[model samples]
Target: MKQMQIYAFDMNCVSHINHGMWTHPRDTSLQYTDLDYWVDFARTAERGKLDGIFLADVVGVYDVYKGSAAPVIETGAQIPVNDPLMPISAMAYATRHLGFGVTANTTYEAPYLLARRMSTLDHLTKGRIGWNIVTGYLDSAARAMGFEKLPEHDARYDAAEEYLEILYKLWEGSWDDDAVLADRARAIFADASKVRAVRHNGTYYKMEGIHLAQPSPQRTPLLFQAGSSARGQDFAARHAECVFIATPNPQAARPIVGALRCKAEAFGRGANALRVLGLITIVVGRSEKEARDKLEDYRRHASVEASLAHYSASTGVDFSKYSLDEPIEQRSTNANQSALAAITKEASKPVTLRGIIDQMVLGSRMRPIVGSAEQVADRLAEWVSDAGVDGFNLARTVAPESLRDFVDLVVPVLQERRLFKADYAEGPLRQKLFGGRGRLPSSHPAAAFRT
Candidate 1:
């Protein structure tokens, strides 16, 4: 079996995808404000020989449920979040070979500004940065940014397509490879003629300028996207080098992965060019009983209200409006349409409020693996073989504790079986993952814009 890539799935907040797990006695997520927390995390990931840490983010609060923010704020449901990009530099400084995949929505941010920020980080981290492109899904985010409501779902992806064109022009085409001429006699840091301006006038954006910064190590940061809708999947097919997906089971994930690969091939990309990673949470211990006990202990801290608030925001449905046994009626709203669609359309069975709560019992709908290290590794291998997934984005149940358990217990077993890396690879995140050059491959659509 091929070695699997693992990223420490997380967010820069008191609570992330798991919702109310911050109250867990062992969770240190509340220390998100402290720089040391991130630094320590980076070190721990490196020690585990993990590929990277994927940090999820949102620009605004979750105010879709009850049409207000109080539920989110009161339960700490991603409301007290810090900027995802803030702690990354410190984390990079603390560890070598640990990539950072940080999420930033393209809807509200200017392309040039975001490009510069990513380039700066690429330079600082020596090309270990990956950007998870997201179109803002929250109506609250739109309102906060002065819009009446969020743009239609497909329209956002359309806008993102144009956004990527502009970014690619800046990142890959504006400056020639040999543009930088650091010669004292010439007194020229860069040859201006070698750098050209990028001009674009599209339905969503218009820009006429050269790239603001000199090219970093990797001209373009590693491209990642998490969109499971038809339009979203199409967008990922065109531009995403890595794709994130979430499903209730590996059986469910298999067809989605197949469809995504087919879509990528339809867009003239290699079927295997894009790597699909599934979100999963595991609670492994020396024995199955210990793992179950740990899960129960963690459940004592799970906040039902917080989980509901998170679900409400993500699906644009207010769980507070429904009783526990109510069958969740599917309706369109202005949040993560794909997520909502998955629960409603794709599921083999109907999803109910109780079902949702049960799913969140261990943080999201990902199947949990419990038992010894060998048992956990065997399950992961089975998922890889059966689902055709590239790897797993392991979510933390309790802060560093969940991560620590995986590293100390499961990693050794995986390494022993030769299913994971025992040492860091010498390159940027892309090279580390793909075992090729650090930049986007020439076959990628973004590479077509290169000068």
Candidate 2:
């Protein structure tokens, strides 16, 4: 039996994937700006022996729903968001083993600058950091950046390939592992001859500079990608150490998981090279009835309008124009093709305005698992076996409350069943997760850049 890897999925805002849940009396997402909140979150995750805390981010507002950002602002749906990178150092200081997988969009960032920032964080976190690489889909972000429109869906992925290649050169190639000598006897701080400047003259970018920072514990932080699109999966296959997927259920997850692994195999990566995590939300209680009751309580605060607003920006379609019974049309867009497909073309049934609302059971497409500790554990085990996923990026429901319950109740059941580790492994995140060296494997594409 393979032990499952779990990450606490959250965002630095009131409403993340589960929109409108901030209104719940128990929810304290408003404290997102406070460093203590993230520090506490990191501590709790470490206590639960979770693999990491995945912090998601969006560079733009959800204004596509009704031709305005009012609905999103009124409902507090992923708007008023903060930078995910800010709280990381404080959180890293508070926890020992809990990794931090921070989402950063390559669509807007400069490769050299981003590489330096990640390397700095990697040094500070002592190698318990991972990058969730993303090519953003928000037109609002593009407009704010002075672009008339975002690059086409496949075009963005195309640039991302070049972007990551430059990052590999900066992180892995520029600095030799032993560039820092610190030779006090010889009065020399570093071997300048060992460090080389990275030169990239690619289709998307041009750079000729040395990496600002020295090699950290894991020079290239663990790469995590969540591109469910076809081209996206191809990108993940080549570079992603961990792949995140948001599907309706275990059945929906299997094929996507298989596709990514198959693509990875074609790239000459080993079978276990990529760890795929399906997104899920769990509502745990001491009794089955208690969980159901909690589910009802949570649902009462959920806002469908907020979900629509968020979805509009995601799929590049305004849901306000559609009638209740009208079938939503899926068209080619520069936005998240995978997100739109999940509710439209790929759905088991023809999705309508009403169907869209119904599918958002708790203000999210990710339906929650309501059960006792034993039941939650059972569902998780079944997902791993039936879906063929490594584990889940458990969506945060009632903030620290749901996570607290999971660690206290569900973790024990999982450990008893031999489905989860009772203790964490030693070393950097990559080694802890894969049980080997703390850096990219020799077969990995990034390794080719190494000196």
- Per-residue C-alpha lDDT of model 1 across residues 1-451, encoded as one tens digit per residue: 9888889998888877766688877788888899989999999999999989999998888776677889789878777888899899999988889999999999999998999999999999999999999998887788889988889988998899999999999999999999999988979889989999999999999989988889998889999999988888999988998899988678878988999999989888889888999888888888888988887887777777776777788898987788888888889786788778877876668888888878767555554777778888988998789888889898888888989999999999999999998898898888988878798887888889987
Q: What local distance difference test score does each model get? A: 0.87, 0.91
lDDT of 2 by residue, 1-451 (tens): 7999999999999889888888888887889889898888889899999999999999988889989999999998988999999999999999888999999999999899999999999999999999999999988999988889989889999999999999999999998988899999999988999999999897899999999999999999999999998999999999999999988789989999999989999999976899999899999999999999999999998899998898889899999999999998878778899988887788878889888888888898678888999999999999999999999998987887888989899998999999999999999999999878899999899999999
Prediction 1 global C-alpha lDDT: 0.87
TM-score winner: 2
Runs of candidate 1 with Cα error greater than 4 angstroms are: none
User: Which lDDT value does model 1 have at 216?
Assistant: 94
In model 2, state the lDDT of residue 302. Answer: 89
